[model samples]
Target: MSFAISSNDVRIEERDGHTYLIASSRDEDGNYNHTELNLDECLGNNEGSFNWSGEGFTGSAENIHLSIEGPEQLPILRAHLRDSEGNTHDRDVNLSERIVNDNGCLVFQ
Candidate 1:
C-alpha cells in the first residue's frame, strides 16, 4: 500500500477500564521515524503537540487485542500510530505516571 502522512492526532480507546493506543498510522517496519513519534518526543517536554496537551485524542477506534508487555517499574510504552495511508508505526513512549493508571494513557514526562 502507498504511505501517506496523516495530519491528524493519535487516538485512544478505553473499554472496561483497559486503554488502547490507536492512530492513523499502522504498526509496521519502515514507518517509525517516518510516521510514528514517541510520547516524550511527541510531547517534546511540552514542545510538540501530540494534540494531547489541549484537545486530546480525536478518532474513532476499537480495542487493541495485542498484548503489550511493559517494564515493571515506570514502564515504557510502545504505542502504535498509523499514517494517512494506514501504515502503522511503533513509538517507544514514557508516560507521566510512576505506575500505569487504569486506562493506560500516554502522558509524557
Candidate 2:
C-alpha cells in the first residue's frame, strides 16, 4: 500500500508557539483512526507535500488523510480521508474533557 499527502488539503498553523499537522485514517470496517504529527518532526524540511511507499500494513491498513486548522483559540482540524471501501472518517476529540468518540467506531477517555 502507498500513502500520499494531498497538497490541497494540507494545512499549517502555529499555536502556543508550536505547529502541528493533524492526520487521520479510516479502515475497511468503517473505523476511523487519527494521529497528530508535529510539524517540527514531519515538516521540518518545509515540503509542500509528503509521499511514501513501503511494506503494506501487516494487520489492517486504514485509508488516511490529513487536515490543518489552528493558530486560534480553538483549533478545528477536519480530515476528509476514506478507507479502501470509501468510508469517510470523522472523529471528535475533546482534550480538556478527556473524551473521544469516532462515530461509534471508537471511544476513549
What are the Cα lDDT values of the candidates? 0.32, 0.30
Backbone clashes in candidate 2 total: 0
Cα lDDT over the full model 2: 0.30
Give the C-alpha miss distance for residue 62 in model 2, angstroms: 34
After superposition of all CA atoms, the RMSD between model 1 and the true structure is 15.9
Model 1, span 1-109: residue lDDT tens? 1112221234444544345444444333423221322332232211221234422222311222222233432233444444455554454443323212222222233
The residue pairs found clashing in candidate 2 are none
Q: For model 2, give the 10-residue run with minimal summed lDDT.
A: 43-52
Q: Give the local distance difference test score of model 1.
A: 0.32
Model number with the top TM-score: 1
Pick the lDDT winner. Answer: 1
